[model samples]
Target: MPSLKDLRKRINSVKKTRQITSAMRMVAAAKLRRSQSDIIAARPYAIKTNEVLVSLVTRTNPDMHPLLRVREPKRGVVVVIASDRGLCGSFNQNLFRKAETFIKQNRDRYEDIQMVLIGKRAGDYFKRKNVAKRAVYTIGTPSYELASEICDDLIKGYVNAEYDELTIIFNEFRSALTQVMHVDRVLPVEPMEAEDDMMNVEYLYEPSEDILLEALLPLSLKVFMYRALLESAASEHGARMTAMESASKNAGEVIGKLEIKYNRARQSAITTELMEVVGGAEALKG
Candidate 1:
């Protein structure tokens, strides 16, 4: 039980909290809308580019391109995309857990396993882990230049035999309330099964197939990376918006309960004071 003054203070504190949460929810919603639009626009181009790139890779000699060359699974690296900030409920945690499980399960498969973490949260979460970090990046906004830089680094590492395989782990934005975890094998480009009609149909290239592939493969990879970043950003915003909305609602409920308590306490105090005044007056008259 608290006095009227204490109750009033608590109600004020909760009201302030509710205001903050409400503001955060709105801000997240605005960001989410922008992120959603970006991802939606990028998806079609990314998918089609990947399809064309895969078709070309399968028909050509894998040894012709270093990126297409698959090597022994001795060493591997996982690129994890997460948010820099907290308050996105379970967004970072889920990714961290998935990455942990992946590393643990494949520990016996790969002789060496390292991490390429994007976002501050990932750096913080994996800092104490036994795994080694190849690179850490802050995820500010998804940009083509950033994607190209990261793709080039990974390509360089793979060509230099620093790592045998590359996998990217990220959250795919599905809806405001739902996100799908995606684990994509980004390097050592696997050949997709070609359709029967397409395999038989030979098309002429103005440039040599090798030249076309040389340009397309890296671009495809960069597009994929960019799309992943967008998806992650959108998912983070969605998660935060959902989380903040829930917090605001919970705060409102708590305020309601506290107000009831405050009212009861104030009423009790008033009733006691009134009773004392009446009793004193009656005694004076007597």
Candidate 2:
């Protein structure tokens, strides 16, 4: 049993912590809203681009574009997205778990396996291990510039035959309280095995199909990388907001329990003093 003073101090400390967590929850909510909107806005573009790519790939040969060539993976790489900062519950933990599982499950497929980590948490985790080949911790926010640069490097690696396959792993934003983890193959793009009548749908090209593919295929990959980053950003914010809210609620519960304990302890002290006074008076009277 804690003393009344100790209980009171605990209560106050918990209240202060509750305040901080509540504030963090609000900030995370704001950031989440902004990120969510951005991802939502990007969805239409992603859909249309996919439609175009599907049609184009059906009409053109896979050899027409460097990104479309599929090969057996000899050296495989995973691009993992986590967060710069924590307090987001198991967001990063779950992501890292998925990444680790991927590596373990696919270990037999590749002679060489490596990780390309984005954000501080991912870098920190992999740095202690022998698996990380490269890391960039400066991904403070999701941006087109960052996405473009990442895609460029990945494409360069693929073109140089540095890696036969690449995969990107990240969290996909579903709702404020929910997120889905995704493992997407970054290269070489999976060619359409079956072209439907949808692919039969054609249009006039300003330039030759080869020229269009040369430009569009890379653009398609960049867009994909950008979309994944956006999804990850939104998911991170949502997870943080949820975690903060839960922390605040837990703090409230602790404060409530502490207040009850404080009241009980104070009452016990007062009762003890009253008994002592009564006994002293009785003794004096006797």
Candidate 3:
């Protein structure tokens, strides 16, 4: 049993903590709203781009483009996206675990496996393990410039044949309370399924299909990378919001329990004092 004074102090401390968690919850909620909206707005554009890419790939020959060529992945790179901060429950841990599992499972197949970490948490984790090949540490919440910079590095690696294959690991935003980790192939663009009635459609290329593909392929890759970053930003906010809400609720419960304990302890102290006084008066009368 804790003393009444100690219990009171604990109650006060818990109240302060609850207030902080509640404030964080509200902030995360506000950020989540904006991030969710951005993700929603970007989805249609990403989907349409993929659809166009699918149509184009079906029409073009694999031999005509370098991107469409499928070769054995002797060397590969994995881009792991995680949050810079770690107050969001298991978001960073889950992503790191998934990335680690992926690396372990594929270690035997690739001669060289390199890591390109996008977030501070991921980079730090890999750096501690001495496993990351290269890391990009400065990505803001939702910046196009940051996305473009990462895309440029990844493109350079692929174009130079430094890696025959590239994969991206990220948390996909499903809902406010749900984020699913996914691994997406980022390079050596796979040929998409052909649509029916391909000859009926006419594509007028100004500088031939080869030139169009040369331009579109890199742009398409950048768009995909941007979409991934946006999704990750939204997911991070969602995770933080949910975690802070849970923390606030837990803090409230603890405060309630502490209040009950304080009241009981105070009552016990009062009862003991009353009994001591009555016994002393009786003894004097005797």
TM-score per prediction, in order, is 0.93, 0.93, 0.93
Clashing residue pairs found in predicted model 2: none
Cand. 3 Cα-lDDT: 0.82
Report the lDDT tens digits of candidate 2 across residue range 146-201.
Answer: 88888788888888888899899989889978999999986888877544555465
Cα lDDT tens digits, model 3, 1-286, are: 8888899999999999989988988988898889878877877877777666666666677567766666689998999888887788888899999998998988998888889888888777878775747656646675666777877787777777778898999998898799999899867887767667544568686777667777778778878778788888888888988999899999999999999998999999999999999999999999
lDDT (C-alpha, whole model) for all candidates: 0.89, 0.86, 0.82
lDDT of 3 at 50: 68
- Per-prediction CA RMSD (Å): 1.9, 1.9, 1.9
Cα displacement (Å) at residue 161, model 2: 0.3
Off by over 4 Å in 1: 196-206
lDDT per residue for candidate 1 within 1-286, as digits (tens), equals: 8988898899899899989988998999999999988877888888788667767777777679888788889999999999889999999999999999999989999999989999999999999988899999887788878888888888889989999999999999998899999998988877666666654446787588789899898898899899889999999999999999999999999999999999999889899999999999999999
- Rank order (by lDDT, best first): 1, 2, 3
Residue pairs with backbone atoms closer than 3 Å in model 1 (clashes): none
Name the regions of candidate 2 deviating beyond 4 angstroms: 193-204
